[model samples]
Target chain A: MTSLAGLIDRLEDAVAHRTPLEKEHVQAVFFLFPLMFFIVGFILMPVLGTLYDAFMRDVIFLEKEFIFFTNFRYLFSDPGFWNAVRFTLLFVLISVPLELAIGLMIALVMNETIPMRGLLRACVLIPWAIPAAVSGRVFELIYNYSYGAANWLLRVLHITTEPVNWLGSEIGAFIAVVAADAWKTTPFAAIILLAGLSAISEDLYNQARIDRAGFMTRFFKITLPLLKPVLVVTLLFRTIQALRVFDVIYVLTGGGPGGATEAVSNFAYKYFTAGDFGYGSAASVLLFVIALLLSLFYVKASRFGEA
Target chain B: MRGPDLHTIRRRVSGRLLILLCLPMLFACGRGDAETDLVFAVGGAPSELAAWEKVVRKFEADSGISVRLLRQPANSQQQLQGLMVAMKSKQQNPDVFLMDVAWVGLFSAAGWLVPLDNLDRTPFFGELLNRTDVYDGRLMAAPVYLDGGILYYRTDLLEKAGMTRPPETWRELAESAKKVQEQMRPENPGFFGFVWQGAQYEGLVVNFLEFAGASGGIQLQDETGGVRVALKANLKALRFMRDLIWEYEISPPSTYTEMQEEEVRTFFQSGNAMYERNWPYAWTLHQSDGSPVKGKVGIAPLPAPEGEKGVSTLGGYHIGVSKYSDRKADAKKFAAYVTSKEAQRMVVLELGWNPGRGDLYEDEALLERYPHFGEFKDIFRKARPRPVIPYYIQVSNVLQTYISGALARNRSPESALEHAQIEIDSLEQRYGRNPEGGGGQLSESFPYPSFTHGEAVP
Candidate 1:
């Protein structure tokens, strides 16, 4: 009892003689409480709920029973899930490198001494500024088989005798969707690369020039090596985004032409919309794990942020 | 100025903090007004909503109840998803739901809709009211409008081709469409023979159902008292659909990518296709002054195979009071009002929606305005409902996928049907035979209660 009283006395003394740092900490906690509450309540809770739902049999009006790993077993055996994974990987493989190369070229051009460089940079970002859904609709129009600009251009150039059904076949739909996605997101990569380029010291380039290095040589050795961290970061973001590609594909083809363009996210969304929440949640959890592994691989492979 | 004491500062800060916390609560409490606001959730084109808004105003004035119209996603699948989410969460804001005909069984089976046993359904078409309105031995929804797949053709082109009547068989229609296309190709280079909703969506399922029904294709059969897929007729129908695109070249290759009703309507309205299979609403659009086919359009029942009668897939919207609604009485009142004969007449005349009431089809003014209400009534009477099972969404998903694959030439019709049958069987086993507890009766027979018709639209 005496020790308890002594502890209480110590606590009261500390409170009465609180330091400025302690007062500041209390104030910071008060300010951050709402934000912390929002993050935990909205984001964290839903994620945990999804994980919980993944291990249960959840259908509408049916009793939800805890059936551990059954949903995962169904997913593993489901051809649609595997098809979605294949297409998602194919999309990432095709779109990310094209985005990186085209983005790097644009960033290099924007970094050079040129007239109206700011305007040019702004114009390059127009595609990215447009919402993905709106851009998707625009691309849908552009790829229309009967009256699209693409076919008109092809006809005017005398390239083909007939208009191509850009979204009517599997490979055609896949290519068209990939092009649309790359068109909308390449500018984002370019902007990031441009930022990285700006951060590199101009003196380093001058020093390379003094060493009689050619443009190609300097590009390979200096720009790429120095831009590694930014490139890794940009690739990680784009890779994750590409794996879960949905909006453009949903609007453009709706994973049609025999589900040729369905991404993992689209597949999960289908199950979710169909009210098979358990299977959908399982697919989502698998997607989360894949994304985590991919991000880890990228970080490790690039030795990101290392000297 | 005198310096404030520490206690006073603490009290002031605490008071401000309390108000900040209570502000949201205060606003929430402020929403409790005397006037009851009933929310009706609906989906469709903005123009369709505009037509319904007039009806809503009349109802509001008569009942002295304010209504907030909540517009849902235009896509039917997305709309269904949104409603399912809201109902799953038991939201009470949407007192009334404007549901597609197919959703009546699913929603009612899930116990999301209130049973409107007292609503007088005698005025509605017997088939629609009996087949789609009832669920688990209860009248769950009231039909607001009736729709079915109809064939729209170019009258001028058919006349030019020396044909006075629309073709009645798929073979005949194909020949006529090809003749018209070849005849018109010299003048209109963009012309095609026929167009329909071939996209891999619900519309595709509706189109397939029409063809399948006409060809005597039963999706499910009672074989030895066990439900099984009847594959032969479905395979034949699928082959015929595929031939429309690849073999006959009647439909454009782009049909594989078209996803909505509007796409087919646009092709037909632009005078690019000789014939279009679509819902009844397309007739009004095609007859409007802005359409290229205005005054040149004709409506008829869809062509069937040789040994069968023409069949149209049943479709329309029904109004139901949400089980979660706080104002069920008001919601039921609104539902009853919108489906009343007077409102039905106005909607039918103005919006080109087929009235649910059988007697309205025979009204002199309505027949004068529409001119083809007789044929429409006949089609609705004989319209075949898509399988009325609670797991219909999943079943339709599987059907559309395989049917689309067959149409796209990604898989043979035989293989596609085989695959689809397997998937559908699994869906049945997983979800149970019938979620509606209807004893897995295949809906081949009219098992629900029937109403006496005032007058048949012969």
Candidate 2:
């Protein structure tokens, strides 16, 4: 009976010790206030401000009043707004896949043993390293109908009979923008895949080779299955980038050749820069929503990268 | 010259290095950080910047104000954002800023500029320039050196083509260009027809307006003055531009959507263009020895369409004190000083800018010093403002959009103009204008590039 009581007492003591202490967590609480303020002030406040501004009646920032989604309601009828969305989606859908394919090819090349491979990897980064605006202007020069090196080279090589207007036609300008973007950004994907490739074991490839596997057989059986997480991660990163594509399109076309290249960002810029704060905010919020939805869809469609 | 030891040689070398280090300070470039600092911004190639640098030095010497010239975009939206940011940051360093005349209207409406009426204490800012800066009777931005569009032609090319005088009509111009371009010199594809700014902006409106004016189409009829029809003329003028690209093929169709100033000038300077429509700045820059057409270049009024009056709209940067500026007094002083007779003389003569004052143009002494003033003063008198409305930007945007479509996208000029008129009515309605300002009107003073319903005469 005493032994049983002693055991009960020990168990009761254990429960008593298990109870959490009531000591002040001063450090965490103290740091948390400013952090919360920062998040609210910088992030939440601007987001809400954009949302609030979108519904304003007048374009004049201070003069505006709550018109309650009149901007969006008007936006549905606006051809310019629709044109921007359609073109922006087209830019994303086309540019993203091309970039991914080009990126994967380059990544595969970099994965192979080659002379000065480190130097070659860095060289590939040169295009990606330059600022987007700078690259945009550079591409503008490249695509200039007159005195553009692109046409000059083509003419020199006898590839075409006449100087093709890269920016003159709607589809041509669209393709020019996509090509410039792909050229600027493919290295980002390459580097991501390179990291993924580095993690991939050569021993698995050796075993597959010993099993008399063909190139495709080895790739599908070994490399692709292992690299799925990294591939999805690289793809997600590229898609997010592709969705907000703006500067290159802006510098290349200025949404010209009759609004052929107008992106959501360009539309937002035209309004915001013109001080049409309300309309600009509506366009910007719409852009943000589109980007968010696309990102969420991509992350989900990649099956949380577990596939 | 004693044979120096290593120590002596090192000391001499160090002394020379010190002199080189102090050279900038000695030149006074380093001395004036806080001295009467003023910020003036302009946009152009580097050579143009050199002209403003001279203007700044003169201002510094005359007024004892240390000048900080901020060279940024002349017409970019970044300029507006930059000004707003500076105002918010409370930076008073740049005392004076440059603003385009059209931008002045928008900026003035925002009440961002100090009323020039308040600057009455200064003798430099006369009432005439100040009065024009006002919006709704409240004074804002002041006109600095103004700009008006002009046509530049290759004298040699025109003479070679046996057209003794420049074309006075669009048809004559196109006919002459087609003749000149077909007889391309054996060595080069010399003398293309024409070039002008055509991207969707204020520049395009000017091009559209000039043609419309020259075409005998009228926009706002001085109902009292008998057939006030400027906008209609503006559209007729635009159709001429369309015909030039699509019908004549004399003008570079590729340039219909180009928004560059220098690109057009380059073709003219390279002696590949017979006639080019550009601002006076192009004339100033093209007169240099580097231009193949320098000695043979001719500055003439733009061709009027079919016996109509030639009209050129005023284009320029204006100086204004910010309403939000704490240093409003200093800002007003700087504005007036820059526009003063003496400063005007220096600016015109040295910087190749046209002076706002007419008297200076005739001032024999000033003309003796600067000869171009005598030449351009006649042109300056004819400078007209675009339909000076608060919603002028909206008007121009619609006009430019339609014109670009008509010219570049191959839309018929008539269809484009008709579509533009409908768009203008809708835009005006959105602005809460009562269609015709409630005059039971035939038309709502549509400030678009004017066109006519009448068929093009064969």
Model 2 ranges with Cα > 4 A deviation: A1-45, A57-62, A159-161, A203-207, A304-307, B1-71, B87-96, B118-132, B217-235, B257-259, B369-375, B418-431, B434-458
lDDT of 2 by residue, B1-458 (tens): 32334344334433443454456667696454444455665554365477667767877787676666777665455776676565544555455677767666566655566776644324322443543466777657666677777888888888767888888777778888887888773555434688877765557777777777666554322333122222445456666787776678777756755646677888778877888988888876788877677788888888886756676767777777765554667667777776677767766766767666656767887777657666666666666666544455555656666677777764667667766665555544444454354332224343434345443321
What DockQ does each prediction reach against the true complex?
0.34, 0.09
**Model 2 complex DockQ against the native:** 0.09
Worst 10 residues of 1 chain B by lDDT: B449-458
Residue A249 alpha-carbon offset, candidate 1, angstroms: 0.6
**In candidate 1, what are the lDDT values of residues A120-188, reduced to their tens digit?**
999999999998899999998998888888988998999996678888888988999989999999999
DockQ-derived CAPRI band for the predicted complex in model 1: acceptable
State what share of the real interface contacts each candidate retains: 0.44, 0.15
- Score residue A181 of candidate 2 by CA lDDT: 94
What are the per-residue Cα lDDT tens digits for candidate 1 across B1-458?
A: 32344454344444444455667888887785433689998876787788778888888888899898889888888888889988998778688978888888788777888888667877777766777888767889987778889999888888876888998999888998888888888888778899999888889989888887788866343433233343566666788999998888888888978746999999989889988999998887888887888999889999998868778898988889999999988888888887888888877766787887788888998898878888899888778777666778777777777778788888888767666665665566556664454333223322222113232111
As a TM-score, model 2 comes out at 0.81
TM per model? 0.89, 0.81
